[model samples]
Target: MMELFFKDFIMLWSTIDPVGTLALFTGLTARLSKSQKRKVALKATTYAFVILLSALVLGQIILKAMSIQLISLQLAGGIILFLFGLQMIFSDPEEGTGSREPGHQLAVFPLAVPSIASPGAIMAVIVLTDNNMKTFTQQAMTAGAMTSVLLITCGLMLIADRIFRVIGHNGSAIIIRVMGMILAALSVELVMTALGVQRWMS
Candidate 1:
């Protein structure tokens, strides 16, 4: 049971990469005051957690009812993730430049939806909960891992300002670019796997 949990945790962790998202969160909220930024991080993560958990519980059924194949869903998710990655890599961090005043509430959009409860993360949780794996405990473990990862991500975001001081904008940009490249490669792999082109090495 421990082994299973550990394996699932690692898999989820790699895909989620809370530490990596910390840099992006820091970049996104750089303009806000200390207290406002903290509020934003907390609200964002809370919303992200709720959405992700709901998706985990109902995503498969939703897909099935829509007559969607898992592979097709994966392919679509990969494309979305790839596009998001490109945005992270190329778009200016201050492009939107929200100046809605310091006390403005921030939650779902930039932080929760895309940053934490990302399309890639949603797809991954659904994929990992495949029934082929067996046992309700295993399924629950997958959910646990998802919860754990988002908590970690939220915790990191809470410390975004300090982290930004250390890594700076340029460093975050470089990391985002690297993550984008990795995500692109992974997206291509997802597409190939969906197309049933296994054993390409031969």
Candidate 2:
């Protein structure tokens, strides 16, 4: 049981990649004043937590009613993850920010939507909430862990000034590319699993 939960935790963490995305998100929000930065981080992460937990609690029924299977979800999520990974790998680091107005908000759209509460994370959480796989208590624990991870990510971004000074743009690029590779690989694996190749191998 412990081993199973541990595996799930690691898989969740990798799919989410909160730490890696934190660097990018912080860079995008870099121009905001310190207080504004903190506010955005807190608001965005709080929103992410609520959405994720809601998904975890109700995702199975919702997906079933929509006639969606976990395998199909996995495959779809993998494609999205791969596309995002490609963008991260090949695009300019500055591209995420685009053109910014003086009062542009960072907490709502890209930062919270695709960055933290990513499509992949959404699908992954939904699948992970399978009632057949574990007890409700275990699922709750998993949700808590995910929330904790997001909070930590927000904290890291809140201190983005000092963090960026240490790692710089080059370091950030390296991390993004590395995360992209991992995401691409996971995407492929999800496809294969959905195709039932893993069952054959077993």
Weakest 10 consecutive residues of candidate 1 by summed lDDT: 101-110
**Considering every candidate listed, which one attains the maximal TM-score?**
1
lDDT of candidate 2 over 164-193, digit per residue (tens): 677666676786677667767766777778
lDDT of each: 0.71, 0.70
Per-model TM-score, in order, reads 0.73, 0.66
Q: What is the C-alpha RMSD of each candidate to the true structure, in Å?
A: 3.7, 4.4
lDDT of 1 by residue, 1-202 (tens): 7787788788777767787667556655666677878888788778878877777778877988999876676577667666767776787756655566542333665467655676667777787787666577888988887888878887888877776677766766666677667657766776677676766654
Off by over 4 Å in 1: 85-92, 99-110, 131-135, 167-202
Cα-based lDDT at residue 19, candidate 1: 73
Candidate 1 has a TM-score of 0.73
Measured with C-alpha atoms, the lDDT of residue 18 in candidate 1 is: 84
Model 2 pairs in collision: none
How far off is model 1, as Cα RMSD?
Answer: 3.7
RMSD of 2: 4.4
